[model samples]
Target chain A: MRKTLTTIIALALVAGGVAACGNSDSGGDGKIVLGFSQVGAESGWRTANTKSIQDSAKEAGITLKFSDAQQKQENQIKAIRTFIQQKVDVIAFSPVVESGWDTVLKEAKAKKIPVILTDRAIDSKDTSLYKTFLGSDFVEEGRRSAQWLVKATEGSTDPVTIVELQGTTGSAPAIDRKEGFAEVIKADPKFQIIASQTGDFTRAKGKEVMQAFLKAHKDIDVLYAHNDDMALGAIQAIEEAGLKPGTDIKIISVDGVKDAFVAMTEGKINVVVECNPLLGPQLMDIVKKVVDGQETPQRIVTEEGVFTADQAAAALPNRKY
Target chain B: MITWTRHRLFWPVMLLVLLLLSNLFFTPDFFSIQMKQGHLYGSLIDILHFGAPLILVSLGMTLVIATGGIDLSVGAVVSISGALACWTISQQSDQGSLGVVVMAVALSLGVTALLGAWNGLLVAGAGIQPIIATLILMVAGRGVAQLITDGQIITVNSSPYKVIGGGYLATLPFSILLVAIVVAATALLTRRTALGLLLESVGGNAEASRLVGIRSRGLIAMTYIVAGLCAGVAGLMISSNVSSADGNNAGLWIELDAILAVVIGGTSLLGGRFSLTGTVIGALIIQTLSTTIYTIGVPPETTLVVKAIVVMIVCLAQSPSFRAKVFRRPGFAPPAARPGEPGPDAAPAGPADPTETKAEVPA
Candidate 1:
């Protein structure tokens, strides 16, 4: 049994070595080999983000080595180490969390391989570690949502009671979005947020919370969700309550996913502030630039647009996510 | 009065009532039900409607825990079943067809039953610990669910399928009716037959149960299958409610809630003397607490802390020893120690030890 165990271990090591050698050889043809790590398909927004990265990599003719970390930081660290070993030309990953990337990132820097952060930013103080951070500004998304709400409810002297359906509490998007909306809405004395609760960025919780909000506050005039899924859920609750969602309770949300566009066309959601997840094309451009020893900005924000019901109809047919 | 208070379900019912009453403090119309477009609409109905899934899952969990086993994979089963049903429905040419929806539901439940059978085999045949056996599926099942949906949320526009969760039946949410039928069927299957007694005996003492010629292995396996089926139904309700299936978020952490419900329902984790009514009340209490948090205007950051405190209070209130200790002042009579009753301290192995009778069945 001992001899067989030793033999099995030896064979496994040999197999792993062969696999590692094969990975290294794939980049030997002078093509730009890019290793990208993703933070798993936790939501529709994330799925779209991943598809964008994969498709854009193909378009750029970059040899992509992709790894899904499944929302675990340790898995991401392991993938980065493997990328370092494979000696890819560029490394990019959407960090699962903002912290704890300093160690793995320093290792990449030691090998002189530039790392780019996508869809999310890291909290590391060292700016020299990564080439650039490419993603949407969640706070700006929130500001745009508030801007649309302000315009829609303009000239109304009556107090517009808003019920805010936040994302997961303490998350970056939740905190920043709340801050930006509160900042923008602070200018209008007629706007009052009577109830604010976390929907955990999920459809079920959003619906459940919205039901409770409707019960607690009978005169809610507007609903702001941190994400589109929650808005969709709240729309159901609004409909069940015999209230017209977009007409009776103006609904504004972020994440211009396909479902949100459908709801917009249905006139359930009033507007959607797009937190664009399609950072793939821009990410590949930055990766090529970094590989060619060109200077890149430390931060690159993707351009997004706010859509209303009318725009949703024209955009519905071509909606990808 | 003494007999009523002594009942196992008494504390859970009282706690649920207290939770519902607390909501009245925030919203005066908490108990008022209104009719809207031929359907009942109110906080109470919402609690029942939303709490149905937890009640169903906990009912099955009560049986499994009664059989001396835990099924951590119920959450995973929920996601897998929902993912399968939605995927199947999405594949149909006519997604709104009742026949197609029924086929999808049947197929999903059938697959869930097979997964349950696999867990049962691992526990009974392979002699693996129940927690370990189910944990395998609990981790892998999400991946299977994600694979079914191709790591994307599958949304369907099936009106017939939506009736299971979001529709109304005779002015009540269909989900509530579904829960009532499942609870009634489970109660009848366990109490109106020898199954309940046999399960309690096996859980009370596995060795003694085997000596009594009881098929403990098959019984344990059947409990897991029932748990899987309960989770399957819950998955359908959840997906149908939203008209979409999210593999990652569907029924997430629901097994933990079900286990908490089972425990709060006065069912011991050591597995004997289960209470279906208590589980139902416990689920309602949880749902009410969630509603109360929002109604009472608890801050978003402090919601979890508030929930933990409420759950802790309910758990402490259910414990006889804790109640006795708290009401031990000189002027106050401990609730557990009434005037005509021997105190719980006096009778160390009194009515509380129902497992004692089952342990002697082999003799």
Candidate 2:
């Protein structure tokens, strides 16, 4: 039938297009074809992270086939399937929110295209599904934030009434950071979280929710934002209320973005726990290691640190994390 | 009593009052206001600044709603335009060049317009539902934005952009002025032209409008194009404000807020009628409620629940069916009715005849 012939031709074209992407020099002292699926630009840090990978790929002589999933898991799955069809040598992606990736990872494993998670980690029971996760330890980042608070309010008579501006609910960072911070904060009876809610990791919602927190709570001694954006938003609300932000109420946040350091230098924010986003060098190192048939760990933990106002100011000119 | 209560705005107003009263009881200095730098500074101004984008997008949404079409892609359009503007500016020889800023704005608008037309073509020419058609772009546009930025925040040291996003014009924000212009222009466009009439006709009855030679499809597509333009403008403002082209986070979840604003303004999501003034007021109310909650020190965890309740109340109040039912109950009087004496009986004023009014038309 004409319809069947047309269908066959259409199928052939698709197959040919995919096949064409695979004719690069083989991995024997030549370029390695890498299919990099990125969680679409949703934040400043994500944008920076993506650029790192792309630039690194160019420098490392890898033929990169990039796909942006636009912050959806389904799209990521489809992109991965396409990558498999293309038969790229290695697969790298930043999973958006960190679940529903097991089957896709298994498929990548079956294809022998090693998977590397950038920025966020997955919750898969099968550890072998991914070769390694190249990102900051989210738990440690949270603990650093709580530890700063514990030290700051050690001898204060006023029971430290803290409010938390959480990141996206059910996200890897949100889940792990909450667990890690609570692990430390639960030990002290005086320190209480009067209000803790998701700002959805957005500036607008952070400001909105912080406004409500300010209205309802009479005495919030400290604000612990899951990310710098929320903390910055809370700062706006704090200043609007004719109250000093870092001085009147001690503020601590995670994600040592350049803006966070700027806030710290201005004395608007108290401290920031760094979650390094510039993973270009590490990602390149891992990609080369994988392609060279060299053994690498299943998790490559990036070092994280906490910085106060003085440290933030001192390090502002040179801090890349 | 029953006849008098059949108004939509009654419920939303009541809900607003209830929210305010609750805040008064719970919050300290919930109504506090201060003067700073020759302008009002408080939770109120903060709400306005934050809510301006929602209001602008909602105004755009009002027209699309009037045509029985929804724009799920506005958020993505915003991201793309924001990224485009930032990337374009970053490519300048001089970082803060005005030529680059103007070119960036123009390029961003052109691209967004093209994308908007793509949606319009699918919905109008291909006869796809607006929701499904726009949803495709919603999923892909952000990816395109990321591609434009090479998945990195394209930082620009542009003065014009800083002014647009973070710079103040005398005492007010430049972003606020931009929003005002968009709102004013849209209001005049709809109110001062026959375009509004045509849109309502198409939304109210597409077949009837077609029979009357209105070219309904063209009108529908035009509304989308305009909405896209508005979103592009919003994108420029957002990126300029942040001084970075972060496509990922530039305008995430903005579409939802715009939808909420449209709904709160009593615009029927099913389409046919819209109110630009009401949309602005609605955005203000939502922003104020949010500010009040934060100022009053509501637990941040409870804020979502509170917002949900507020949305529900506003929606219920605006529903004619809900209003009619509430008014028919005892002890209920119409908002406009006198307090002491019942102005009218709970029955039809005259012998009722079944007549086909525009209000009775099924969507």
Candidate 3:
């Protein structure tokens, strides 16, 4: 008899706890409740991206529910389900990977909650699951880098020998950036890619691989790094090899991080193609529009700019990331 | 000749030489060292310089594995140590001041020592399994590092700090010199003292060591502390080389590499005999393999697959049982006796004997 009573009390307590958790103040006062799931703080760019979204939500007076998935797809799905349970007005997330998000999106769709993708997109055939996708075009960023390289070497008839430092193997940005650069550079017969290798998007690997490249090929004329961090690393390797970075080899890279801008001012990096991480204000605007039952574009591309060494000093003060 | 060939380091050393030589097929200057600006510049020098961090971490891992403990948290400790040092340097009024750099190094090493002590307490004092104990720090230490750097890459411009990793000492990279000093010091400390024997005893049989009045708990804890100090210095080298601390990416998966180096160096995970020389050779092989991939122009997508295959071949060569099975010729010797067993000359003991015989000393 005593055991049965204890069991009944324990069950009642669990039920009470569940009830308390379910009673969240989501849209209770007719205010917008936005659920945003972010990728983990893996790099400076990602940290800045998270901060932009948070700061923008406050400025827009939207009650934001933020969750960090820590680079896991399952955590993201769990966060979305909780948002659905709370009946949030809108849901948005940066998918860690490009696949395996269809089931969660379908669940959100079944509940009539509008979903938005940020920073990274998902791979799904059903377009009706999410309201819109907002991010940068990595391929365009790569093309811009190649175009800048071509223009910088316009009058010189000397064949350009380029050594490429790619990002992690099989990543979306690495694939797109390589494709876009190859597509543009193929037009010029003088532009030749002598060697290319993956730096895994880290400074140490970049420097190590660049050192090997220097030893293997002494006549390298150009270097194209997929990210600014790798470019900065390659600059160090180039300097250590007793060669001037910007002058001896015209260095071109993507992701206009603050360090890259600093390098440009120092004349170590020649050009940086911007991949803006500050998409918070725009993401908030989209969320407000979707919540108000307004039409949103299927894809929203953030506007980015290219900065050269001459423009770096003037742009350094305004750089956010 | 038989004795020389039977030495544990022979296979790993041969593999290292083979990997370095294979690079010659692609780059003819793979072995040439040029004097440029009073410093050595060559592919060989780059391998040693880049492989220094791995060597230091593997040296520490050797001792820990000898004591029957696995430190999965060394990678996290590496990230934390670098993050703390870079963050401290960034906060200073004069980031380039030698005094500030020294303080940052001391502070980072001190904190990592404390983390090591925490792991030690969990394993030695609480009697928790070593893998699970170190695993706790492995997961949380990254978060702690991210907090220290405020979830961003902390970049510092300190010439004094850079000297530790990138600068030249005696016309060689400072990182290579640092690894040499640490490896030599560890060799002397372990071989010239009774600490090694006691560690072997503890790992061979905890109860026997306890009965022998060896303070197994304290000894185990000290090995972890030493491993932490080694990893802390490696962290400084890595961050100083890059001039930045990336909480998420710095020293990521380095623990696995260190463990691989230790295993390849002839240290058993079961924890008995260990070799420092073999570990150094193993680290060089891994670094050389990485350089070879770039030099030979392996496709970026297949880089990992190539590395995996090379590692597998080296591991197979190191396995005596595999060799014994493959080469069943009359001239070929049988597999060496299991560790902690009597030599062929001695009277054979019972196979079920739990007590370990300290017949052979680790070279």
Candidate 4:
């Protein structure tokens, strides 16, 4: 493990070192240099988020000094410190974990470098530490998924036994999604979550847990998965159990990735709640506006699309992720 | 009379049986298998199927621990091998091609064997502490796996590859068959030949084995390579089952389970006197517990706690001191004095224990 730890640390150092060399104190062309700290490429969504930011910065002609934190809070802190040391015009980052950022954000604030929060939110109530926050409201994502379910299962007077394949337990998405789903379904007496368990946001655990759910409950009407990966896994388990996924058991999931769309088109998945990851253009716009001395909104919610099976066939070919 | 009770497998087998019996209360047909489309389906069958990967890894771990070494890198090797094989297959124009799948598996195993040798070299040749030595690969291996996978879950569509994990041959899960073949071959190589005895000797005393002209270095390295090969196969099964190689999540924390299986299988982490059957049973016990967690409706938060309690009971059952302390109370006889000092109850499973296994301590 020392080998990998050394490798990640060295990689971070080299990245920061090379960028630091490009400009000793000021960036080229006398343009605004936006220092961006990303939360590493841990998922397809994060990868897309990184790409969008990079592409948008280039298109906008801003000097983007980027640092990948490799999903560690310490690395993010280090990158933020480096940004402060370099005296970039504007500093922005997606905090890996919510807490432990007050001290660092305070430093950036004291230095008069405006910070922008992207993709995720931090727990600190002090909004003045950052100029603006732009991302999807995770609780809203959950509420949207459940609302779609309610509309789809409209007029269903019979009891709907929904087996929930939750994401990693206690994560923001998992907790918010559960709350949102419950908030919508609670009013309706027909829908009841008879069994729910964490799949840990992985396909293998999703399938294993779903298979057990299938065996334990024979009257499952819906499989509400916390993410697309788990829904896809549950589809396989349902198929292997000699049941049609979309027909016999409807699957509604979050994350409108291409795979989920393909599943939706195949009628294996019923609907998908989209979590917009393409925040680069918007983030770049916000950064440029913030730097232009314009008062931006404290929180900017990105517009997202909800896809049904009817829309999946038309959308699959152009799916960017 | 206590000879039977002193047998290495007495505690593990007893724990396994007790667990199985306890399941009968919740699942009436827990042990009964029904034919679903000419294939077995039941809690017992699921145990063997899902237990295949752990069985393979633990079988290798038993040998490594038998030589007084622990391979913490097995889980990482699993993720790496799975990532490599899946990546190679996904790159192929025809992922379903049998020839390409074979090459992918071979290449994956080849790389894993080298990783094993790296651990072995650090421990046996460089004379580093076994835990610290293997820890290097343990930490770095998964990162390398994620690197190979390019930080994305690589899903493949190959029937032959899927067969390794989910396919059935003659109404039995192919994975179970794979485990059986590997277990039988491993048991034969260790018990029928003198290799097992040689390993036991090296693990029992590295200094004494060296003084007796034994090549301890070669044997130690060989065990690690074997462990790597086993981990590679297990990796294939995991990725194949899901048709996806999730570098971050695949085989996460599996090394701990493998080590626990080895310990529970009557093999000391200090090394020597291993049992393949016992390891198989131990792996099944772990898998059954997981299945029980789901079937018996134990919350996910409390799942690990329940496992910890079960492990404690199993360890206590195996401990002669603990057993003696409890049994010595209330007019009951304690387990036979020690490994060599056998009594009649221990005689059932140890027809040749006194002769071949001198320092064998299941506890």
Best by DockQ: 1
Error of 3 at A64 (Å): 3.1
Work out candidate 2's RMSD over C-alphas. 5.9
List, residue by residue over B1-363, the lDDT tens digit for candidate 2: 443333334455556567666666665465676666555554545666767767777777888888899999999999899899988888878878777788888999999999889989988887878998899899899888878987666767788877775556756766787788888777667667767667878888887999989999999998888888888988887776556677677778788888888888777787777767667767777877766665554554477888788788777776666655776687876444656655433333211211212233121
Instruction: Please list the residue runs of candidate 1 whose C-alpha ends up more than 4 Å from where it truly belongs after superposition.
Output: A1-35, A69-90, A96-113, B1-4, B325-351, B355-363
Each candidate's number of clashing pairs is 1, 19, 0, 18
Model 1 vs. true fold: TM? 0.91
Tell me the tens digit of each residue's lDDT in model 4 across B190-263.
Answer: 87777888998999898899899998999999999999999999999999988989887788889999988877
Summing lDDT over every window of 10 consecutive residues in candidate 4 chain B, give the lowest-scoring window.
Answer: B347-356
Per-prediction DockQ comes to 0.69, 0.36, 0.66, 0.37
The lDDT leader among the candidates is: 1
**Alpha carbon deviation, residue A118, candidate 3 (Å):** 1.7
- 2 or 4, which is superior by DockQ? 4
Error of 3 at B344 (Å): 7.2
lDDT of 3 by residue, B1-363 (tens): 754555566788889989988888899879999998899999999999999989998888888898899899999999999999999999998999999999999999999999889888878887778998899899999889989998888999999999888989999999998888888887777778887778878887777898989999998898888888888999999999999998888888899999999888777898866778878888888889998999899999899999999999999898766665677567665344346655641322222122332333435
Full ranking by lDDT: 1, 3, 4, 2
Q: Report the TM-score for the A-chain of model 3.
A: 0.86
Docking class of 3: medium
